[model samples]
Every structure is written in C-alpha cells, then in structure tokens.
Target: MNAVVHFLILLVVLSAAAFILFLLRAPFWLILLVIVAVYMAVTTVPTFHTVYKSQNLRAIDRFLLRNYRKPIFNYAYNIGHGTDEEIRNSLRTIIDKSSRGDARHVYSALLGVHSGDGDEVLAHAGKINPGPLRSYYYAYGTALNGDLDEAGRIAGKITDEWMKHTIYAVIAKKQGNPEEFRKEAKYAEDASVGIQHYLLHHNFRKMAESFNLSQEGSSMMQLVENTAVELKDGRRGLILGVRDNEEIVQYDVELGDGEIITVFAEEVRRPV
Candidate 1:
C-alpha cells in the first residue's frame, strides 16, 4: 500500500515538473537532470535517512556493502566458548552500541543459557524488548535458576514453534526425562532453519551428551569436532566445523588434498 502511494506521489511530482519545464521551454538535458535528481531524492535519500536514524548495525553494514553478513552472533558464541579477552571486549562493544530492540542481546543470552548461567541470561534478557525472544531467554533463565514449572508455563505461551519446543526440550532435560528431551528436541529441530537451527542443534547435541543418549532420530547428526567422515564424491575428509545455514546443512570438511570445502550434509557420511 505504501509503495503504491509512493509511486503515485512520484508520478504526480514528475508530471508537474515536466509540465512546468515544457512551459518554460527548458533544455532537454536540463529537464532530464532535474527528473533524475528528484527520483534520487524521493528514493535513495529517504532510505539513507531511515537507515541512519535506526542505528542498526546490520542495516548500516548492509547499506555500505550489500553482501555483508554480520559476525556479531559468532562473537557472542565465542563468548560462551571461553574466547580471549579481546574477542569478549569486541562483542561487548558491539552489544553496547547496537539498537536496544536489536536481536544481538538474544544471541548473547542464548550463549548464557548454553553455559547454564541464569544470572547472565537474566541480565541479557532485561536488555531485550518485551517480546517472544525476550520471553524465551527469561524462561531459560528461570529454568536454570531451578523453576522448571514456571519456565514451562512461560514457554507454553510462546507461539514460535522453534522457541517453544526448544525450551520444552531444555525443561525436559532439567526434569531428567531423557525420552521427553529427545522427543521435544526432534520437534524443535524440524521447525528450525538457518543459523537458529545450527545453534539449536549444537546446544541440543551438548545437552544430549550430558544425558548419555545417542542421537538416534534427528536429521542433524551429532558430529564431534576433529572427526573423520566420507564425502559423497568418494573421497575422505575431516570435520573442521559445522557452519552453514538454510534448508540444507553443511560442514567445513578438509579433503585429502588439504582443501577445505563446505559440503552439504547429504554429500558427507560417517566412515563405514
């Protein structure tokens, strides 16, 4: 609807300018320049202004470079993995400067939840807006603080399938029900895609290991670090990292020729 309105307005403005120029007998080149300038003013300038006022790091980064993907989430993940001080400081700086409604805090809170730090998760939760993402972290923090019932209650109201089932899985794990955890985790994994799926799978794998349960039914196999696997092209490789997103899962695998390639999950398999 807004696009239609904008297009109508542009059309009217251009028509008026053209009429006035025709009446004034303006040069063809001069009229064309004015129209081009008006078009930029009506389109590009407002886009730049909106991005500038929002102060969204991702938006600003994309404005400068169309293909840039923010590494802020990776930095937060590193924080939970016991990264160096410099990396932690960099993440802190990014979080501090990011817009209040930005989702970076949630990523950090997820890491806190992964580490079982209720305090850290709560702190990050407070920084987020009142929404499903904030509620998700709040429930995780509550669970970590030993209130499984309340956490489950909070999670039950969440509408996002991924968030709801993932939290249920966490609550089930806390309740020492390995079967429930496995069931809920399968649902969660099925509903998730992209980076959310990757992160959730990683956390779920770690939680599953804690229960001494083999991942039997999940599509995302629990591939450990530094493991050997076979590529689909009849070659061998070592798992370097699991770091792809979207409908297809991918892994960073180093081939026998010492070349690292990000191959799809179906293109790799466990050694026979």
Candidate 2:
C-alpha cells in the first residue's frame, strides 16, 4: 500500500527474525541480528512519528474523500448530470430514510446534480423532527439550496466552529466564491479548510498533507476524509439543525457514500 505501511511491515519482519535467532542459541550472529533489530527500531522512531501523522493526520482520510464521496460533483458535471426529476426523487427517498452512513452521500448526491436536487433534499429534511441528523440536515440543506436565510439561521444555532465554517464554505460554493470558501474552511485547527479549498482548485497532494493523521487523530482524519469525499462526490459540506427532543439527543455520523455510517440510537416512540 503506502510507504508507511511498508515500513511497519518491514519492522515486523526484522523483529520476528531477531526473535527466532535469539531462541536458537545462535552465538555471534544472534547478537548481531538483535543489534540490527534494535537499531532499526530506534532509528525509525521519527519516521514512525511522521508516517503516523501522515496517516491519521492527512492521507487515508483524504484518500477516502477522493474516492468515495458522492454528494458534490465537479462543476462542469452539473450541466449534463442527472435529470432534475430523477435527482429530486432520489433525494427524497434517501433523506426520508437518512441513516448516518447514507446521509453524507445523500447530501453529496444532491450537490452532484443541478441545484434542483439540492432543493429536494431540503424538502425531505423539512419532514423530520429536530434531532442530530435533522440538525445537520437543516444547515447543510440550506447551503445547497442557496437559501441564505435558512442557512444562516441554522448556523447561528450551532456552537461548533468546524461545522459553522464548513457550512460557510458550502454557502460560498453555492454563491460562486472560492475565496470565501477558503476563509471559512480554515476556521478550525482540525479542519484544514485551507487545504480543502486548495484541493478544490484540484491539488490533491497538498490537500492530503493538510489532512495529516495519527492514531489519536482518527476522528479528525475521518472528518477530513469525509470532507474530501464530499468534495469528490460533488458535495462540499452539510448543515444540520439540532434540537434536543424526545426523538434525538445525540450526534450521529454517516460515512461517505453510505458504506460505513454511525448515528445515535433512534428514538423509540411508545404508545400513550
């Protein structure tokens, strides 16, 4: 796969060989082997750190975004993409069922089409009660439809700066201003909006670097990755209007393209 993975695998092999040699009571060679093994381990620390950062902080997540996001589409693709009616119908069906995984892609699919599909996605969101997904839908939905009133209203209620900036960038995209998008994307330390905006100009490598990753940064990594996919899928970001009601009270997430999604537990309505 990647260079970092290759390095780790190599480390494993060396360690294993050194262990076996020690077990065999081998004399001079075993000592030499162990020394080499120790040397390799010690020398590779910085590389490991760098690679770890690159993996969790940047690469894998961006790679996911590059390949799997389905919401947004290339600007030119909007012209002759799916028909308005088809897009509308699909948006309705998907949003009505809105599990965590499918949510982002549904948004992605909406962005991929002409603005008509974006309208339909919001319409579907309107039918839901306030909760986590609905929270996201409200903001994300408004951005897609060029409904600045609703978008701003929803964003005003969100406390998370990352979500706010992400939505701001989306609004900028709909309004046709890359500069504004870049400004919003950079609002968060974890979110490399600066890099995302650059990549929007089509520099994927730089985007990956901005998304640097590590074990502890997996969540941020996934966010970058999901954001990347949104870019790839023709969707930029999502807007959710959250309310704490009987139906929903926690955050829910969906992986890009509907493959691996996670959301909070669904509210169970009991008969009175």
Candidate 3:
C-alpha cells in the first residue's frame, strides 16, 4: 500500500513538471507526464491486490513463526501419532510458500486457514492445548514429596536441559522474584509436552527405541501428563493414529451407550 501511494505521488510530480515545461512551450514534457500516469495506474492496481493477499498470509504466519512453532510442532506430532488427524494435515498444506521458516516467505502459508477468521484459528489453538500446560506441572519435577524447603531449593537452582522452563519457575520463586516466577511458569506451561514433538525432536529420536515407532512420532510429548494419549471414558485413553498411510485410528475418550467424547483435530480447507 505504501509503495502504491508513493507511485501515485511520483506521477503527480511528473505531471507538474510537464505542466511547467508546457507553460514555456517546451515539447515532450506533456507526453512524459501522460506516460508516467498511465504506467503508475497500471502498476498500482495489481500491486494492491498482491499486498492484500500478503496481509491475509501474515495473519496466519504471526502465530506459527519461531515465536510459536512449539504448538505447531505439537500439532504435527499429534497428527503423526493418534491425536494427529485430517484437520491438522490440511492446515500444513497451505504454504503460499514455505521457505523452511524464513521471514519474507511467511505468506507461503498465509492461506493456511483458507479464510481470515480469528475465532476459528483461536479455537484451533484452544483445542490443541485446552488451557495452557497447567496439567503438566507436576510436583515431582518441582520437589519430591512436596517438601517445601527442599523443593524450593531444587526449584530455585533448576537448570535441566529438557524441562528448563518448569524448573526455572520453581527456582525463580525461591529467589523471591514473583515476576520472574510468573513469566517462567507460563513459558514452562506452554512448552510442556506434545507426543509428536518428542518423537521428532530430532531425526535421531525417531531411530531410537525410546521413541516408539508404533506411535509414529516423537514420544517425548508423553513426558508431559496430557498429550497424544489422553484418558477417555473413565477407563483408558483413546490413542489415535494412521494405518498404512490411509486410515485414521481413533479413540473413544468418553464411552457409554449413548454418550461419547472423542478428541481429535478436524481438517480445514485451504484458500485458492
């Protein structure tokens, strides 16, 4: 838009230049203005549409960047495992262009959602994690047996490579920093766990026995309490999966004759 506006201004300036020349009966100046104006009009229209398309793409990219791929990594992990599904698959298909996470190439996936609607996108965010990673915050990692003094010390001095966020929040409180504790807690919470994330955290993890090949993803998400294998029907979890690259394995989270609660992502269309 800014470029288009500047181009129009340039045309007006050329016109004035031509008008001044014509006042002195100078030749070629008037024709110069006309050519500039015609070029500007033709160029601006298509550029405007291009800009409009870009804006739509940014809306989707903002949340999926390095600043936010943990969730998406979680999403992909889910889809690859049991929680992974058709909806998640469709979302990844939009890549106005995917530059392997480059900034300028973000529009590559702007139409990832097919339409510009915040509510729907947010809804997807919620379904992915429900309410942050609160459930994953267990006492064992903070301190054993809920012993405050020991727990406080461990939490205060935590520096684990894997669960840094969760451990740091504990340490922050021991240092008597409420602000630090809150901030770190949220980070730890949001970064809690996703099954697929752990599975594919590295190409090596996929080859290791720790990551089950049967689940088809990074099993690290299992470290956090709630992820791919969620409890269902007051009995067991409804683990999901893909069969021979063609079928969706489902779980019955809630089960009874007439009532059932199933948790899985649905596919959304990509925009043309």
Candidate 4:
C-alpha cells in the first residue's frame, strides 16, 4: 500500500513538473532533473523520520537506565531480554544485594514462585506489611506449598480487584482448573492498566502457559493480523501483530495517531 501511494505521488509530482516545464518551454534534461530531485526528497523524508524516531527511542532507554538506576528497572530489563539462567541470576543478585523493601520481597516471591520454593516465598511474605499485597504473597506461597484450597481462601480476602483476581487465577491454575483459571485470569487482565499490566503479562506468562490457554489463530480472541479494532478506551487502532503467549495474548496496536501501544486481548474489542 505504501509503495503504491509513493508511486502515485511520484507520478503526480513528475507529471505536474513536466507540464509546467512544457508550458515554459524548458529543455527535457532540466525537467528530468527536477523530477528526480522531487522523487528523492519525497521518499527520503519518510526514511529520515523513521531513523530519527528509532534513534530517539533508543536514547530515551539509555537515559532511563542511566538516571533511574533502580534495581527493579534492571530486573524488568533482564526479564524482557535475558535467558532463563540470566533472569535467575539477576533475581538472586537483587535479593542478595538490594536493601530490604517491597521490591525485594516481590523479587524474592517471583523467584520463589518460579522455583516452587515455598520457604523462599514465605520468608518474604512474612516481611511484607500486612495488607492485600502481603496476603497475596502469602496465598501464593501457600499455594506453592500444596494448599490450593487454603490459598484460595486467603486470596479471597484481598480487597484490591486486580490483585484479588490475579491471586485467584494463580490458585485456580495450581488447582488444575483450566476453565476457572481462564475466567479469573481474564478478570485480572481486564482490571490491569499500563505498566502494571505489562509487568504482570511478562512475569506471569510462563506460569500462564502451563494452562495451554489459546493459540494465536484462535477465533475466540477475535483478533486478526493487521485488522482494525477499538480499544477499551474507545480509541481505534490497527493490530500490527500479536504476542501469543498461550494463556496471555497481547496486541501491538498502531493507533490512528501513529503511536504504537501494547494491550492485552481484553483491552480491545471489535470496532463499533
């Protein structure tokens, strides 16, 4: 489509320039030179803009890494880009060296959940101040320790909707109820927004895959490659691609304004 547009644009420009030159009785060589110049300018401008945008994004990433300097930032980067062994090493180093805080507890709990080490999970769960968050960690730890019923009971007490639904989904997964897991997981996914959603999808995706949820081509998702869809917020976008992580499906949507954002399947709907 872009190629066709560019071709039509070039043809129109060249035709216009040739007509003007003919009216002025200019030489053929001069008309050809002007057409070549116009074509080069039109095509190269988009290339330049694309290259500048790519470089700008990279620069922003470098600036964040330099100034943010948080252990969690590094952990997020490693989770996205590193191998399983690298992620384990990064988590362990963060646990060993980072000062005790909620981030540390979260790091510990995720590693524990991945490793199925109830003791590791409980160790951090106890340090977290009593609240919905702490209850979630405890419930997850209990679930890891082979008490799905008790875990479900504990998770049920969490008041925060997203956290509550997420814990329940995990418990359902542990209990081997795929239907319950999918239902609760969708609730959690729907309640999440922005970066919190990103973190959940990335960190919990492997565990989600254990349920063998849905495929990229599943019509149940109602998503097709490059199709237009409406966001939950009523914005329209084109689906650039699908990130099909079994139980978790995210779409890279290019909005009408040309800003690309990642959103979970539940965050989008068929265009109205």
Candidate 5:
C-alpha cells in the first residue's frame, strides 16, 4: 500500500515537472537534470526519514529499517562508537515498536549485549504474542535468572523434541549436574545434542571422566574426535571434540565455514 502511494506520488511529481518545464521553456538537458534530482530526492528523503523516525514508522518501514539500518547500528554499537544509552534506547524502541518479524531479529541481537537487563528483556518477550521462538527465549532467560523449575516448565511447552531437549540440556548445565545434563543431552535428536554434550564434557572433564569407560571405549572416543564424518543433516564436518556420556557418544564437528556443531556417533559416516 505504501509502495503504491509512493509510486503515484512519483508519477504526479514527474507530470508537474513536465508542465513547469514547458511553461518556462526550459532546455531539454536542464529538464532532464531536474527530473533526476527530483527522483533522487523523493527516494532518498523517505529512507532518511524512516531511519531517523524509526519508532514512529509503520510495520513495513520498521521491517525495511531492520534489514538495512540495524546492521550498521549494531556494528557501531559493538565498536563502542555509539553511546551506551543511545544504543540501548534505539534497541528498546525497535523491540517495542517493530513488527513481530523485525522485533524478533532485533531481540535476538539485543541478547548479545551483556549490559542489557536479561530478565527485563525476557519479560518484554513474554508480553508479545505467544510463539515457540519467543517461548524459547523466555525459558532461556528464566534459566539465566536461576529459576530452573520455571525454565523447565516453560520449556515443556516446546513441542519439538530437539528444541525441548536442547533447552533441558542448557538447564542441566546451569544446574551443574553432569548426570542430568547427559540425560537431557541424550534426548536431543539432532546435532545440537552433540554441541551440548561437547560443552558439558569440555567444561566438566573430571565429572565426565568419572564414568570410567574401558580402554577400548576411550580409544573409540579418540577415533571419533580424529575423524571427519557426514552428519544426518548431510553436512560433512570434522570432529573437533568427543564426549563419552555413559552409553551415548557425542562429537563436536567443525563445518567447512568454521561453525562448531554437534552430531551423534550414529550420524557419522565414512568421509568419501
């Protein structure tokens, strides 16, 4: 709707320019330059206005700002180029005023800023329309707030087994219970389980080693880490770490682009 209106305005402006040029007997080159200038101003002015008045912009305008301007703002914020208060206000406005799609992206980015009050952000996210994504963040925030029971209850609303288990694994880690962490990690039916398992064992090697596996089990674990394997998701990644969580063996894999992911022993295939 906004695009249609903007297009119509452009057409009217061009028609008016042609009429004025005819009345003044303007030179053809001068008329062409005027039209180009008007076109540029019409297009450029709105973008500047939208960026400057983002909180007042409509949903579509906010979406556009998120895609185009937010990244630049985030970069500036990260490098300490922007004042902390200014950055916080801008992000808070974006989270509060933007459409759901735009708000979600901004919220995710805002989570990376350590100085922000996480509980406050989670409370804000809970007020948004109910969604699995929002619930995921809310549960994570609850866990971060040290409310494990509340986090677990919120995570229970997640129907996806992979996501539920992943959140549970995180909760387990926060509780510092290796056994519970391994139990939840085992329930994760995706590469995420591998990552969580790696994080747990890497961070708590002594507790993980106390499982007391046989020498053969140790050698197999070492081999799993040394080998490159194809994940069930079809991405081939080199195993960077391995964990023997009782009966489950999880491997940390680094993909070609250097993303650390996880995969189960069963997910591994001989590198072709």
Candidate 6:
C-alpha cells in the first residue's frame, strides 16, 4: 500500500480510539497524548520510508532524500574522484529523476558533454517538448561536439534575444574566435562570466609563455597565489593551488578567517 494511504488509515483509527476514550470519560490528558503520538507517527513514518526504505536509489538521490537539498557541490566533488562508471551512473540517475526544468536540462546536457556523449545530450534535448530553450540546449550540445555551424543554425531559432546571444557566445568561445566571442559577449555580459574567466586564464597562460616562464611557476602564478581573493560565498581566501580537472578548475584555498575549502576557479576572483 502507498505510505500515504497507510498513514491516513492509521490517523482514522487513532481518531476513532481517541473519540471512544472521550465518550468513556477517560482522562483528557491521556486522550490528548494518543492524538499527539498519532500525529507524530504519521508525519515521521513517510519521511523515514522516503529517506531510508526506498529501493535502488542512486547515491546522489539518497543524499538528497536524507538532506533535503540538492547536493550539487558534493556531486561535483565525487565526480572529480569517482571512477568513470560511477560518474556515468550518477549522471544518468540525475537525468532520469530531475524534473523538467532549465537547470535540470543544462545539467544533463553538460554531463553528456563531460562524458563525451554529445549524441546522448542531443537525444535528451530532443525528448524535451518543443520550445526555444529546447532548441538552445540542443545547440549547446552540438557546440560542445564542435559543430559550430549547426549549433549556430539551431541557436538562430531562439526567439529570446538574451538566450540567443548567450548561446552564441558559448559557441564563439568553443570556436576560439576572439572577435566573435567579444561581439556576443557584449549582449550577454551576465551569462559570460564563467567563459570570460576561462578565457582570462588562457590569456594569462599566453602572457606567461611570452615572458618565457613556466605557466605553473611564473610571476603570474605567484600573484595568483599571494592575492587575497574573495570567493563566491564572500569569504576571503588565499589560493593554495589550482586543480585543472577534466570538467572544471578548482582552487584550493586557505581562508583568512579559517578552514581550507575548495572553490570553483570561476567563483574565485581578486578583490576589487
């Protein structure tokens, strides 16, 4: 039986018992205690079943069920360290269970790209009901697979100007066309922060190369290390090292206030 149905039956039975006790002139406090106990059981049992008794839940789903918050950071951390099969299974679970929403679609598409399965991304995109955003994600998958022209054609179908410009900027960045990237960046400023940070990192490496210094051991590297940076969470930290993982760059930082934390590179910026 459904847990909710079971809870409703239990509630009806307890209410009947409480009513019988009242008619029999039992102590008011004792009847009230029974009612309270029934209420607590009804509320907690369903939650317990959802969190602990559900069968075949993926690790991420289990964490979400227990914590009641999307474990995005934890997922990223685990993906960075997990084996390929584990990562794929987790992503597949997320794609299957997440509700239809832009963020969910973006995550699914990105995971497909990260897993080097552009076809899967496009297949998922196609399954979404027809809409401009659906076309945009399909374009994004194509762009990730290095089909810039086709991606551009699909992006051109988007009616929302901001969405169109943002996706075009992504395609331009992937194509390594600085002029095109800048042109798209003008209209998509808010959407381009991460891409801009990635480009800035690339340019910094180029500058280091021009000066005949090792990219990892240059003056720029020293500056990045010594700089007191502000993280996205608004905590100030000094960068300890950068880990350029396959999916994203992470900065290992020691916060001035306390504790060591790993922040995404795009989230760590020098104080203005």
TM-scores of the models, in the order given? 0.51, 0.38, 0.19, 0.52, 0.34, 0.39
What lDDT score belongs to each candidate, Candidate 1 first? 0.67, 0.45, 0.36, 0.67, 0.57, 0.59
Q: What would the per-residue lDDT of candidate 3 be over residues 156-179, giving only the tens digit for each residue?
A: 443442345544554554465556
Candidate 1, 18-88: lDDT as tens digits: 78998999999989988988888887885656343433322332232221124554343332232355345
Q: Under the 3 Å rule for N, CA and C atoms, how many clashes does model 2 have? A: 34
Error of 3 at 184 (Å): 2.3
227-250 in candidate 4: lDDT tens per residue? 557688988666668999989999
Question: Candidate 1's C-alpha lDDT?
Answer: 0.67
Cα deviation of 73, candidate 5, in Å: 19
Task: Identify the runs in model 2 with alpha carbons over 4 angstroms from their true place.
Answer: 1-14, 17-58, 61-116, 126-133, 173-179, 188-272
**C-alpha lDDT of residue 240 in model 1:** 66
What lDDT score goes with residue 141 in model 3? 29
Which runs in model 5 stand beyond 4 Å of their true positions? 1-117, 120-124, 189-272
Residue 250, model 2, lDDT? 31
- Give the Cα RMSD of candidate 2: 19.2
Model 6's alpha-carbon lDDT is 0.59
Q: Per-residue lDDT of 134-206 in model 5, one digit per residue for the tens? A: 6776776777778889989989999867567766876887777767866765565233322232222232332
Give the TM-score (vs. native) of candidate 6: 0.39
Ranking by TM-score: 4, 1, 6, 2, 5, 3
Clash counts for all predictions = 0, 34, 22, 0, 0, 0
Pitting candidate 3 against candidate 5, the one with the higher lDDT is: 5
In terms of lDDT, the poorest run of 10 residues in model 4 is 58-67
lDDT of 5 at 78: 23
Model 5, position 220, has a per-residue lDDT of 26
Highest-scoring model, TM-score: 4
